[model samples]
Target chain A: MTYFAGIDVGSLSTEAVIIDEDATMLGYSIQETGADPVRAATEALREALSLVGVSREQLHHVVATGYGRINIPFADRKITEISCHAMGAHHLFPDTGTVIDIGGQDSKVIRINAEGRVLDFTMNDKCAAGTGRFLEVMAGTFGVPVQELGELSLKAQKEIPISSVCTVFAESEVISLIAQNRPREQIIRGLHRAVVSRVWGMAQSVGIEGAVTMSGGVAKNRGIVALFEENLGHSIHIHSEPQIIGALGAALLARGEIHQK
Target chain B: MHITRKEYLLEQKEKGRRLMGVFPALYPREILWALDIVPAEIWDPPLEIRQAGAHLQPYICSVVRLGLELILQGKCDFLDGFLFPHTCDSIQNLASVIYDFIGARKPCYFFYHPKIPHGHTARDYYLKNLKALAAELKRQFGPLKMDSLREKVDMGRRISELLGELYDLRAARRLDASNEAFYRTIRKGEYLFPDDYIAELEGFLTQTRSEESRNGATIILSGILPNPPQILTLLDDLDVQVGHDDLLNGSRRLLISNEKPGDPFEYMAECYFHMPPCPTRGSSISDRMRHLLSLINATGAKGVIFNVVKFCEPEWFDVPNLQEELKKRGVPSLVLDTELNQGLSGQMKTRLEAFIEIVRVHRESITTKH
Candidate 1:
C-alpha cells in the first residue's frame, strides 16, 4: 500500500507520522530533538517506519513541518507549523475554530475560519514564561519529573499566588515559597495558573472562538489544560499525542500533493 | 569632529556622497561602508503634525508616525535610499508606504529578522535568517570579496566595542555627557559611519569627565526605538543619568562581535544571531527585563524607565509583563507614554525628582539599620 510521510522538527522534539491516502495514521514516532534537527527527523522517520514494518521505498510523498521544516533536505514540501497545526486540529475536531498551542519555547493562539484556514493569529515566541520550558524549570525546582507535574498539581489544596510573569522571577518566587513552607503541589498549581493566565491573555487579545483545541507538547500537561479551561471559562478538546499534530498535517498535505501530481 | 545636521548635509554635498537614511540595527552598514555612501539615521523630524489623519491610525505607533511625518514634510528629500527592518507591524507597513508613496524615487529595503530569543528553535531560525540576509545583501550589492568583507566586519566590531565601553562609562555615571551627545554618538555610529564612527566617539570620550558624585536617581531605559535627542535630553535635563539603555540605538547595536574569519557571510550570520535583540524584533519580554535588571544592578541604578512609543503593539504587549516582573524583583519602574512631539522634560523631571527622593530615603534607612 502507498503511504505518505510527514516530519516535524520542533525546538524540543521531533515527530514523524505516516498515513495512507485516506489520511488514516499507519504509524508514528516521537523523539527528543538533540543539537541537530535534521538527524532527529531522520531518526523519527526510521522509528515510524519500523513500527509500521513498511520500507522507506513504499512512501510515495514526504512533507516537513515545524520550525526546522525547511532544513529537511529530503522532504518534497515544507509548510509552516501554524498552517499545519490548524489543519491537524481541524481534522480531529471539525468545529475547532481556534487552536492554542503552547510548545517548548513559544505560545501561539491561532484563529481559524470554518474551513480550517488561518484567519488571524498571535504568537509569543520570544518568552518562555508561557511555554513548556517554564513548567519544566518549575518541575526541576520541585525535584519531580516534568511529566508528573500535572498529576501532582491536581492534589493542591490551595491556589498559591505567583505574580511574576517572568520565568526567572517566578522560579525565584517558587523558591521563596519553598522557604515559606509552601507545598510543592500548590506551587506547581500556581505555576500552571500563571502560564494559563499568560496564554489566556494572548487568546483574548486575538479574540478566542468556540471549540478551541490545545496542541503542542504543553497540551499533555493536564494541570495546565485544566487551568486553561477554568481561565477561559470553556472546555478544550485535546488530540491523542497533540505534539504529532504538525507532522500528521504535513503527511496529509503530502498525500494531497501526490494526488495533485 | 562634531557636526550639526546642516553642516553634515553641506559636507555630504561637497564630498558628492549619496546621502541615505536608515533606521536602527538593520541598516546594512557594511554595504554602505563598501559603497562609499553617507548613511544618516532619521531620529525625529522638527515638524509638528496637527493630525496624523486616517491614513496613519493612532494605533500605528509614534516612531512610524514620526518617520511618516518626515517623509510627508519632504524632510527626507536628500535621501537616495532607505533601509528599515520589520521591527513591528506599524514600522513594517510604514516602510512600504514610504517606499510606494513618499520616497518613491529612493530604493527601499526591509530586512525581515523574525523573533528568535526564546528557544533553541528560535536560535536556529535566526541563524537561517542571517544566511538569507547575507545572500540578499550580496545580491543587491554585487559580489563581495572575503578579504574586504572581513576588514569591514573588523571595523564594525571595533566601533561596536568602543560604543560598548562608552555605555559602560555611562553605567558608572563617569561621563556627565549630555543626552544629545550620547544620542548623536549612537546615531552616528549605528546609522552614519558605522565602520569609522569610533574616531568621533573616542574624541568625545577623551573630552568628557565623570561626575564627581552620582546625582539624582539612576535609571535604565528599555524599549525598541528611543529617539536619540528627545529621550536622552529629557533624562539629562532631569539630572537622571541614563545608566544604560537596551534600545536598538544603544547596547543592542553594540552586542555583536566580528572576530570570526574565513567566511564573512558566516561571521555576519553568527553576529546577527547572537546579537542582543530588541523587543519589537521578537525577543522575549522576560529575557529583556532580566537583562535590563542585571544592567541596572551593575550600574547601581535605582529604577527602570520603560518609555514605550505610543501604539507600538509589541512593546505594549511587553511593558505590562515587564513592569510586573521588575516589581516582583524589588525594582521600581515607571512607564512613560511617549509621542514623537510630546515635550516630556517637565513631566520627566517631576517623576525623576520623586524617584530619586525615594531611593535616597530607602538607602538611608538601610544604612541606619546596618
Candidate 2:
C-alpha cells in the first residue's frame, strides 16, 4: 500500500500521477496550470491522491517535474521534464531511443539509450516558434480550444502553407488568411504543419534513433503526431495519457528512491 | 583589496601612468604594458544599465550596450582613450557611434586585423597595423623604447605561461582552487598591474595540485566572456568543476603558449593568429567544433556549457552548428543566452540543476554498465 506521487506543473497545464510500490499506476489528474502554480499543483495532487483513496500523509514520496518543478514545496525531488520525459517514455515504451517533448515553454529532443539513459539532447534556444505555446497562441486567435486543434485540422481538404518561422509573424499570416476567407480547417492544417515542421527540425538536430516516442501535451494533437510520423518516416509510440507521462516518470523515480532506501 | 577597479585605475593615473580602455578580442596587451599604459580591459563594467537602453537597439548584445553605456554616462572620462579591436559588428558599430557620432573628447584607436590572410603581405599588413598603432601611441603618449617593449613582452610571456599552467593543472583535475577563485584570480588581469597580477597567480599556484576527486561532472564553458558571478557560484554549488574554458577572456588569449621566438611584433602576431578559433575571427564552424571536441576529450569533460551572450551575432552564428556537431558526436551540451551583470534567473537555476542531474545520471549509468 506504499504509494508514491509525482506532479508536473507545466506552463499551460498541470498533471499528477500516483503509483504503488509495485510500479503499477494507481491514479492520475490533469488540469490547466492557471495563474498560481502552487494551487494548481496542490489541487492536482489532491485529486490524484483522492482517486486512490489515499491521504497526502500516506505517500512515501512526492517528486515534481516540468517548468515549475522548483516551485513545488511538498515535493521530495524536482526532476527536469527532459529527464522525466525520457524516463516516462522509456517506462511505457521500453524500446524507445529518441523522445521528442514539445512543451509549453520549450521543445527538446532527447536521445535515450537501450537502458533509458539520455545519450545527448538539445532544446529550442529561447525561441517560441517550435513549442506548445505557439499552438496555444494560435488557438486563441482562431477561437478554438487548444485541444481541438488536432481534430479540427484533420478535416482539411487542401492544406495551405504557413511559411513564417516566427510566432508573431505567423499570427499575422494566420490573420491575413482569415481575412482572405480561407477555410478554418485548411488554416488549422497549415498551422499543424508549421508546428510539426519546427519540431521536426529539432528532431533531426538530435537525430532519430531506434523507435521514437512522443511526450508532453503536444502528443495529444493527433494531426501534429501524424505530421511528425510522416516527417520522422516511422511510427511513434505515445502513452495513452501523453500529458501525464512526465508525472508518471517522476512517480516511478520516487518509487526507485524508496526501494534504494 | 577593498578599492574599486575604477579607483585602482585612478590611482595608477594619478601616479602619471596612462590609462586606456581596451574593448573586446585580440589586442596586444604587451604593447600597452610596454608603454607603461594600463589598458583597462572593459568587457563588462558592473554599473547599472539605466540609459544604455535608450541609445542602443534592443537587439544589440549587452556587452556593446554596457560598454557604450559606460562611456555615454561619462564614467570613462578619466580614460585617456578607447581601443576598439576588430571583433564583431556590434563592437564596430559602438566604435563608430562613439567616435563619429558622439564626437567625444578623447581620441578613439582602431586596429583592423585582416579577416582573411591573402598573401605574403598578410603578415606584413598585420605588422604595419601593429606599427601604426604604436606610432599613434607615440604621438599621444611618447616614444616606444625597445628595452621597455622587450621587458613587457617578457612579462606578458611569463603571465601567459603561468595562466597556461593553471589551465593545464585544472584540465588534469589537480587544481585545488574553487571555480570562483580560479576565474576571479585569472581575470584579475582585467585591472591588476602585471607584476601584482602575476604575484597573485604565483600565490595561487603554490597550492595548485590537490588529491581531490575529479569524479564530479566536468564541463568546458565556451563564450565571449564570463560574468554576472552567480553562474560560476552555481557551477561550484552543483559540484560541477569547470575543467577548461574556450571563453574570449579565458583560454582564447592564453591558448598560444608564449614561446614564440621572434621580435615583439611577430610574436604578438603569432599569438593573435594562434588564438583558438573564434567565430568572430571568421573561423569556420568545423574548426570551432574540432577545437571544442579536443578540449572536451583533453579535460575528460562530461559536457560543454555554451554561455553565449545574448544578441551576439558572431557567437550565435557558430553555436547552432557547433551544437549540431556535438550531438552528432554524441556529446551533451547546454546553450545559454546571458547578458552581462544580470544575475542568474530562477528558471536558469532549475535548468542548471537539471543539466547537472543529467550528467550525474549519465555518469552513474556508465559506471553501472561496467
Candidate 3:
C-alpha cells in the first residue's frame, strides 16, 4: 500500500496532501508558513503523515510545490504552483480548460488542455494590485478578519466604486471611505470588484477556452468568485476545498513520477 | 576571449590609442577608431550612487544615474572625453547634466540619432550629424583621415557580420553555451578593440557546440543590459536558457549589417537604419512585434521576458502594446522591472519559477496535442 505525498510551502501558508496508489486522498494538513518556509514545510509533511497514520518511510515519493518548493531540502522533487494548480483543477473538473488562481501575493490565469497540461498562463506578480494581499490590506481598514471579508461582501448594498488598484492607494481610499461613514460592506464589495477587474485583464489576455475553474485561497472567497464569474460571463467551477489544490496536484504528479520508475 | 579592461586600455595606449567614455545607444565608433581613439562604451556602471541623485530626477533610470555617478565621482577621469548619444529622455537629461550643466573637465561630444523611422532626407541628415561629430573629434583629437575612416567602417562591418553569425547560430539552436556566457561574450564588444573583439568572437563561436544543449524552456530576454549578473546565475540555476535577446544595451545596439559595398558614410547610415526595430529609437510597435515574433519563431522560444529597467520610459512606453500584440498571437510573455546592481528579489524569483513552469507545461501541452 504505497502512498505519495506533497508539501506546498506558500508565502502565507503551507499545505500537505497524501494520495494512495489508487489516487484516492488519504489525509492532508494546512499550517501558517510564518517567516520560515523550511520549518513550515517539515511541519506540513509531518501533519500529513500523522493524519494518515503513517511514517515518512511509508511514502513512495514526495513532491514539493509553491514559492518555497526549492527550500524543502528533503523533498524528492519540486514543481511550480502554476502547473500544480492546473493539474489539480483538471483532476477535479475534467472539462475545465482555464484556471484563475489568485494567491496571497500574486494572480495567475492559466490555460489548460484536456490532458491536464498547461497550455498558456499570465501573471501579475510585480505589483500587489490584484492579489490576496490587496484585500487583506482593505480588510485591516475595516477591522475585519481576512478570513471573514467574503461574508461581509455578501451583505454589500449600494456598492460604491473603489477606483485605485494599487494596494497603497486602495488602502487610503478604503480609509477615506471609512472616514466618510460609508458602509463597510459596500467598501468590501468595491475592493472585491477592484481585484476582479485587475485579474480579469489577465484572464482575457490568456483568452478563455473551455469551462473555467478557480483555485487558490482566493477561490474560497465566494464574493471574488461571484464577481469574477460575472465579468467572465460564466459560472466558475471550484473544488470543495480549493486551498489544497496545489498540494493535491503535487501529490498527483508525485504518483505519476513514481509509476514511471 | 579574455582581457581585463585596464590591460586592454594599457595595450591600446601603448599603441598610441586615446580613450573616450561613450554613453548608451547608437554612436559611430568608427569615427573615433579612425582617429586612434577607443570609445569605451558605458551602459551600466555598477557603483554606489552618492552624488548623482541631487542632479538627476527621481524618475530617471538607474542606467543613467550610474553613468552620471561614475563621471560625478571622477572615476572616468582616465578617459580623454565623453560622448552622449541621445537614447531616451533620461539619457537626454543625463547629457544635459554632464555636458551642459556640470561642465566636464575634458572635451564633450554629442550625437543625436534620428528618433523617427527613416524619411527621404533621413540618410543625408544622419550623414550631416556624423560629419558634425567628426568635426568635434577633429578639434579635441587629431583630424580624422578619410582613408582611415573607410578602413574603420570595414572593421565595423566585419564585427557586425560576426555578431549576426553568432545570433543566427543561436536562433538555429546550434550554439551550445549558457545564456550568461553568450551575453558576456557579446558584451565584450563594449570594451575590446575591433581587432581583439573579432578574433575573440571567432574563437568563442568555434567552441560553442562542445557542451550538451541546455534542457529548459527557451526565452527571449529583452530590455537593458543583463546587469546584476545574478539574474543570469539564477537562470543557470533554474535551467532556463536565454535563446535570444532584444537587450538595448547589448545585442540590440549591435550593428546588424554586413554591407560596406560603396561609400563608408552611406554604409554607416544604412547600418543605422537597418538595425532591428528598437523601442528607444521610437520604432513602430508593430515593427518591434514582428521582429520579436520572428525571433521567437527562429529560436523556438516558449516565452518572452521583458527585463525592463525601472524608469526606462522608452521600454515602458512600448511594452504594454508589444505585450498586447504578442498575446493576440498566443505567445506568453513576462515583464520584469529591474534595477541594476541590485539583487533579484524573492518575489521576482518565485514569479520567474512560476513562469518557467508555465512554459514547460505549455510545451508539454503542445507536444501532447500533436
Candidate 4:
C-alpha cells in the first residue's frame, strides 16, 4: 500500500496528515510549533505515521505547507496554505466555493472554482486583529483558556461592543471593560464579533462564492463559527479536526504529484 | 561595471555638471538636460526619519518623508536646485514646507503639470509651465539655448525609444535578466546624466536581450516604486519575472512616446501626456484599468501585483477599484502594502508565493483549454 504525508508547520502549531493512494486520510497529529519548526514537523509527521502503523520509508510522497514550510528539509514539495486550504475544504465539502481560514497570525478568505482551484483570495495585511492570535490574546486577558472562550461567549446575555480593530487597543478595551464589571461572557462574545467583523470585510473583497467552508484552528471555536454563520446568514461546513485540513490538502497534492509523474 | 547613484552624481559634479534634485512623477527632463542640469530624482531615498517627522505628519508617505529627510539631513547640499512636480497632495505640501517654511538655500522650482482633461487647455498650460520652468532654471543656473534643447530632446526621444524596446523585449520574454537586475539598470536613469544613462541602458539591452525566451511566471507590477528591492530579489528567487511595470518611478516616467517632435517644448508636453496612466497624475480609474489590461494583454501576464507604498493616498485610493476590475476580468491580483527600504516580512513573502501559485494555476487552465 502506497502512503502519502503532508505536514503543515504554522506559526502557533504544526499538524501532519497521512493518506493513501486513494486519497483516504488514515491518521493525523497536531502539536505546538514552539520555537523549533523542524523538530515539531518531524515529531508531528512521526506521530501521524505511527498512528497508521506506517514507517517513514513507506511514504511515496510528502508535502509541506504553512508559515514554516520552507524550514522542512525533507518535504518533496512546499505549497502555500492558501491553496491547501481551498483544496482541502473542497475535497471534504465538494460544494464549497469559498473558504475562510483564520490561522494563528493571519486570516484569509479564498474563493475557489468548481474544480477546487483558487479563484481569488484576500488576507489580512500584517494585522492580527482578524486572526486567531487576537482571540488567544483576548482569552489570556480574561484569564481563560482560548478553547473555553468560545463556549463561554455562547452564554452571553448581551454582547458589549468592541470598537477597536487593533489587537493591542482591543486588549486594553477588554481590560477596561473588566474593570467596569462588564459580564465576562458578554465581553468574550464582543471579541468574537470584532474578529468576525474584521474577516467579513476580507470575505466581501473576494465576495463569497457558493457554500462556505471554515478551516484552521480557529474554526474549532464554536462561538467564532456561530458568529461567522450569523454574519453570512448561512451555516458553514467545518471538519471535525479543522486544523488538519491544510495538511490533508498537502497530502492529497502529494498523491496527485505522484500520479502526474 | 556599475557605480552607486551617489558616486555617479559626485563624479558628474566633479565634471562640472550642475545637478537639480527632482521630485516624483511627471517632469520635463528635456528642459533640464537642455539647460545643462542633470535631474537627480529624489524618490525613496534611503534615510531614517528623524528630522522629517518633526516637520511632516505621520500620515505622509515614505516617498515624501524620505525626500524631506534627504533634504533635512543636508544630503542635498551639493545639489544646485530642487524641482517639485505636482504629483500628489503630500508632495505638493512637502514642496511648500521646503520653499516657504524650511527656506531651502538652493533655488526651488515647482511645475504643476495639468491633471485630467488632457485637452488643448492642458497642453497649452503644460507648454506654458515648461517655458516658465525653463525661464526659472535659466535665471537660477544659466541660459536655455535652443540648439542644446533640441539636441537634448532628441536624446530624450532616443532614450524613450530604447526604453520601449527594452520593455517590449521583457514583455515578449526575450530579456534574460532577473527582476532585480532589470530594475537596477532602469533606475540608473534617475540620477545618471542622460547620455550616461542611455549608454548604460544600451549596454544592458545588448548584454541581456536573448533570442531564446525565458521561462517563468510573468506578472505586472503597479506601484509608486519597487522599493525595499528585496521584493524583486524574492521574485527572482521564486523564478517570477516582472514582465512589465506601471510604477511611477519606472515606465510611468520613462516610457515617453512622442509622434510630434517638431519643437522641444511641445515634445516635452506631449511626452508628459503620453505617460502611462497614473493616479498621482489624476488619471481616471477607467483609464488606469484599461492601461493595466493592455499591459497584461501585451505581456501575457497571468497576474498583477499592486506593490503600494504605505500611507500613499493616491495609490491607496485607486487600488480597490483597479483590483476589482482585474478580478472581473479573471486576472488574479495581489495588493502588497510596503514601507520604503523595509525588508520583506515573512508574511509578505508567503502572500507573494501564494499569489504566484494562483497565477501558475491560471496559466495551466488556459494552456489546457488551448
Candidate 5:
C-alpha cells in the first residue's frame, strides 16, 4: 500500500500526519516548535512515521505547510496554511462552506466551494489580537496553562468585556482586572469573547456560506468554539484533533497529486 | 538607465532647465514641458518620517507624509518651484500647510481639475485653471511662447502614444517584460525630460516586442501607486504577469486620445476627460466598474488586486464598492492594505500566494468548461 506524509511547522507548534493510499489516517504527532523549525519538523515527522510503523523511504510523498514550510528541504511541495486548512476542513466535513482558522500568529476566514477550492477569504492584519497568541499571552498573565484557560472560561458566571483589540493592551487590561480582584474565569471568558468578536468581523467580511468548520489550535478551545458558534448562529464542525487538520489536508493533497500523476 | 534621478535633475538645472516638484495624481505635464520645466513627481520617496510628523497629523496618508518629509529634509531645495494638484482632502490640507504654515520660500502653484459628472462649465473651469497656472509660471520664469508650448504638447502626445502602445502589447501578452522591469522603466517618466522619456519608451518598445504571447496568468493591479515594488518581484516569481494597471501613477495618467492636437490646453483637457475613471477625480462607482470590466475583457485577467496604501481616504472610500461590483460579476479580487516602502511581510506574502492559488483555480475551471 502507498503511504504519504504531511508536516506542518508553525510559529508555536509543529505537527505531522501520516495517511495510507486509501486516505485513511494512520497516525500523527504534535511538538513544540521551540527555536529551530527544521528540527521540530524532522522530529515530528519521525515520531509520526514510527507510530505508523512506516519508514521514511516507504512514504511515497511528503508535503510541508505552515509559515515554516519553506525550511523543510525534503518535502515535495510547500503549500500555504490558508489553502491547507480549507482543504482539510472540507475533507473532514464536506458541508464546510466557510473555514475560520485561528492559528498561532494569524487568523484567516476562508470561503470554500464544494470541491474544497478557495472562493474568497480575509485575514487579520499583522496583529496577534484575534489569534491563538492572544489567548496564550492572556493565560501567561493569569499564571495558568494556555490549555486550561478554555476550561476555566466555561465556568464563568458573568463575562466581562475586553475592550482592547491589541494583545499587549489586552494583557494590561487583564492584569488590571486581576488587580481589582475580578474573577479569573470571568476575565478568561472575556478574552475568549474578544477573540471571537475579532475573528467574527473577518467572517462577516467574507460573508459566511453553508456550514462553518473550526480548525487550528484555537478550535481545540471549547469556550472559543462555543462563542464562535453563538456568533455564527450555527454549529461548526470540529475534528477530534483540531491542530492536525492542516497536516491532514497536506497529506490528502499529496495523495491526490500522486493519483493525478 | 545609467543616470540616477538626482544626477539627471542636477544636469538639467545646470543646463538652465527649471524643475517643479509635482505632487500626486492628474496634472498637466504638457504645460510643465512647454514651459521648459521638468516635473519631478513626489509620490513615494524612500525616506523615514523624521520632521514631517511635527507639522502633520498622525492620520494623514504616507504619500503626503513622505512628500512633506522630503521637503523638510531640504531634498527639494534646488527645485525651482512646487505644484499641488487638488487630488484629495489630505493633499489639499497639505498644500495649505505648506503655503500658510511652513512658509517655504519657493512659489507654490495649484491646479484644480474638475470632478466627474460635470457639464460645459467644468471644462471651461479646467481651461481657465490651465491658463491661470501658465500665467502664474510666467511671472517667475519668462513669457510663455506659443510655438514652444505647441512643440512641447506634440512631444507629450508622442510620449503618450508610445506608452499606450506598450500597454497594449502587455495586455495582449505580446511583451517580454517582467512586472519589475516594466514598472521600473515606466516610472522613469516621473523625472525624465519629455524628449528623453520618449526615447527611453521608444527603445523599450523596439526591444521588448514579442510576436508570441508570454506565458503566465494575467491580472490587473488597481491602486494609488505600485510601491514596495517587491510585490512585482514576487508576482514574477509566481509566474503571474501584471497585464494592465488602473494605478494613479500608471494608466490613470495616460492620454489615450488619437485626435489631432488643436489647442494644447484643449487637447490636454480632452485627454484628461477621456482617461480611465479614478476616485480622486470623483468618478462614480458604476463608471469605475464599467471601466474595470472593459479592461478585464480586453486583457483576459483572471483577478484584480487592489494594492491600496494604508490611510488613503480616496482609495479606501471606493474599494469596497468596486470589490462588491466585481464579486457580483463573478470576478475575484484581493484587497491589500499596504504602506509605502514597507516591503512585503511574511503575512502579506502568504495572503498574496493564497490569492494567486484561488485565481489559478478559477482559471482552470473556466478552461475546463470551455
Candidate 6:
C-alpha cells in the first residue's frame, strides 16, 4: 500500500501522521518540541514510520504545516496552519462551520464555507495570554500538573472571576488568591474562564459560526473546552487527539497532490 | 526665506537634479541619497480646497488621503521615484493603488519589513532587508561608492543629533517659538539639505531663547506618524503648545544616536531596533503607552490628543486602551480622525480650543483654591 506522510512542526510540539490512498491513518506520533524543531520533527516521523512498518521509499508525497513548516526541507509542499486546521476539522466533523484553534503561542478563529474552504480567518499572534502557554503558567502557579488542570477545575464548587487577562499579572493574581486561601480548583476554573473569554473575543471578530470545532493542544484541556462551550453558548466537537489535526490535514492534501499528478 | 515648493522644483529642474519625494520616517533615505536624488517629504499635501474629496475617501486617514491627493494633483511631477514601506495595511494598499494607477510616471519601490518585534529572527530579517535594498539600489541606480554612502550616513547622523537637541529644548519648554513654528522648522529641515538645515536651526535656537509666551496650554500629541503639518498648525491656531509628541515624524525618529556606527547595514538594523517604537511595531502597547505617558508627565502637559487614522487596525486597537489608561491617570484625551482636506484644520482648531479651555478652567479652580 502506498503511503503519504504529513509533518506538523508547531511551536510547542511536533506531530506526524501517515495515511494510505483511501485516507486511512496507518500510524501517527506526537512529541514535545524540546530544543530543535528539525530534530523533533525527524524523531516524530521516525516513530510514526516504525509504528506502520513503512520505509521512506513507500511514501508517495510529503506535506508540512504549522509555524515551523518552512524549516522542514524534505516536505514536498507546505500549507498554512489555518487551511490545515479547517480541512482537518471539516474532515472529522462535516458539519463544523467554524474552527477555533488555541495553540501554544497563537490563537486563530477560522470561518469555513460549506465546501471546507477557509473563507476568512483572524489570528491573534501578538499575545500569549489566551493560549496554551497561559494555562500552563496558571497550572504551574497552583502547583498542579498541567495535564490534571482540566479535570480538577471541573470539581470547583463556585466560579471565581479572574480580572487580569495578562499572563504576568494573572500569575500574580493567582498568587494573591492563594495567599487569601482561595480554593485551587476554583482559581483554575476562573483561569479557564478568562482564557475562553479572550478566545471568544477573537472569535467574535471573525463572526464565529455555530457548529464550532475546537482544535490544537488547548482542546485537550477539558476545563477550557467547557468554558469555551459556556461562553460561546454552543457545544464544541473535539478530535481524539486534536494536536494531530494539522498533520492529518497535511496528509490529506498530499493524497490530493498524488491524484492531481 | 519664503520660497514656494514650486519655485524650488523649478530651480532643481534647472540644475538637472531629479527630485524624489518620500513620506514619513522609515523610508530608505540612504539609498535615495546615494542615488543623487533629492529626497523630499510630502509632509502636507498642497490642497486647494476643491480637489480633496474626489481623490480620497473621507473615512480614510487624512495623512494618507492627503498623500493620495498630492499625487493626483500632479504636484509630484518633479519626482523620479517613490519608496513606500509596509508601515500599515492601509498605506500598503494605498501604495499598491498609487503604483498601479496614480503613480504612472514615477517608479515606485515598496519594501515589506517583518512585523515581528525584538526577536533575533526579526533582527536578522531586517539585516537581510538592508542587503536586499542595497542590491536593488545597485540595480536601479548603478553601483554606489562606499565612501559616498559613509559620507551621507555621517550627514544624516549629524542632522539627527541636532533634531534630538531640538526635542530636548522643546521638552524643557525653553524654546520660545509657537508649536506651529517649531513643527514647521523641523518639517522644513526634513525637506531641505541636512547640514544647511542644521545651521538654520542653530540660528533660530540662538534667537528664540530670549522670547516669552503669555498664555498657552502645554499638550502632548500621540499618534503613529504625525508628519502632516495641519495638526500642528491647528494646535498653534488654538494657542496650544505641543510640549511633546510621540509620532514617528516627531520624537520616534529623533531618538536614534549615532555613537556606534561601523557597518551601515548593522547601523540601520540597530537604529530600527533602538528607535522609540510605535504601537503598531509590536505587542507591547502598554510599554509604549507608559513611555508616552512618562514623557507627557515630564513635559508637564495637561492633556493628550490621540490623532488616530481611521481604518488603521493597529492604531485603532491601541487608542481605546491608551484612552482608558490615560483616564485612570485623570488625563483627558481627544481622538481626531485625520482627513485629507484643508477644512480639517478648522475642525481640529475648534476641538483643540475646547480642550484647552477645559484645561484652563480646571487649572484656574486649583489656583483660586491655593
Best by DockQ: 5
| DockQ (0 to 1) for model 4 | 0.71
TM-score of 1: 0.54
Distance (Å) between predicted and true CA of B15, model 6? 3.4
Q: After superposing candidate 3 on the true structure, give the runs of residues whose Cα lies further than 4 Å from its correct spot.
A: A137-141, A160-165, A169-182, A259-261, B1-16, B116-120, B209-217, B256-262, B285-290, B324-330, B362-370
Q: Which candidate is the best by lDDT?
A: 5
Each candidate's number of clashing pairs is 2, 0, 0, 0, 0, 2
* Candidate 2 Cα misplacement greater than 4 A, ranges: A55-58, A125-127, A163-167, A172-176, A233-235, A258-261, B46-60, B114-123, B203-211, B227-230, B255-263, B266-275, B279-290, B310-329, B337-355, B368-370
Q: Give the DockQ-based CAPRI class for model 5.
A: medium
TM-score comparison, 3 vs 4, better candidate: 4
Q: Which residue pairs come into collision in candidate 2? A: none
Q: Is the docking of candidate 2 incorrect, acceptable, medium or high quality?
A: acceptable
Error of 5 at A48 (Å): 2.1
Which predicted model would earn the best TM-score? Answer: 5
**Model 3 clashing residue pairs (backbone):** none
- The worst-scoring run of ten residues by lDDT in candidate 3 chain A lies at A118-127
lDDT of 6 by residue, B223-258 (tens): 765534577765676667788887766777663855
Ten residues in sequence with the least summed lDDT for candidate 6 chain B = B339-348
lDDT of 1 by residue, A83-132 (tens): 77877888889899999988887788877767566655566644577888
Q: All candidates' TM-scores?
A: 0.54, 0.88, 0.89, 0.97, 0.98, 0.54
Could you give the interface RMSD of each candidate, to one decimal? 21.4, 2.6, 2.4, 1.0, 0.8, 21.5
Lowest-scoring 10 consecutive residues by lDDT in candidate 2 chain B? B114-123
List model 3 lDDT by residue over B1-370, tens digit each: 3567767877888888899899887899899889989988887777899999999778888988999899989888788888998888788778888877898888888898888757857677788998899998988898888899898888888888888888877777778877788888888888888888889889888989544444567888898779768788778777887888888866676676556448777778888888888877779988998889888988889898888889888899999898888877877788888899887776677667767777776676678899
CA shift of A109, model 3, Å: 2.7
Cα lDDT over the full model 3: 0.84
TM-score of chain A of 1: 0.96
Query: Clashing residue pairs in candidate 1, if any?
Result: A126-B284, B174-B210
Query: Candidate 4 vs candidate 5: which has greater lDDT?
Result: 5
Candidate 1 stretches greater than 4 Å from native = A1-261, B13-16, B50-54, B101-103, B118-143, B209-216, B225-234, B258-261, B345-349
lDDT of 1 by residue, B1-370 (tens): 5567757765775777566677644545665555555667665565677544545766676666777777766777777677777766777777777776555577776676656554667656655655565565556555656566677777777776777778878777787687677776666653445534677777777877565756566777876656534667756655667778877656776647645545655565566656775675577766777677789788877677777766768778888888778767767666666676666543243333334434444444556799
Q: Which pairs of residues collide in candidate 6? A: B62-B338, B62-B339
What is the C-alpha lDDT profile of model 2 across A1-261, one tens digit per residue?
789998999988999999999988989999899899999999999998898899988899999988788789999988777778778888899999999888887777888887676776767755688788899999999999999999998888779899985889999999999999999999989989988877777777668889989888899899999888888777899888888888998998888878988
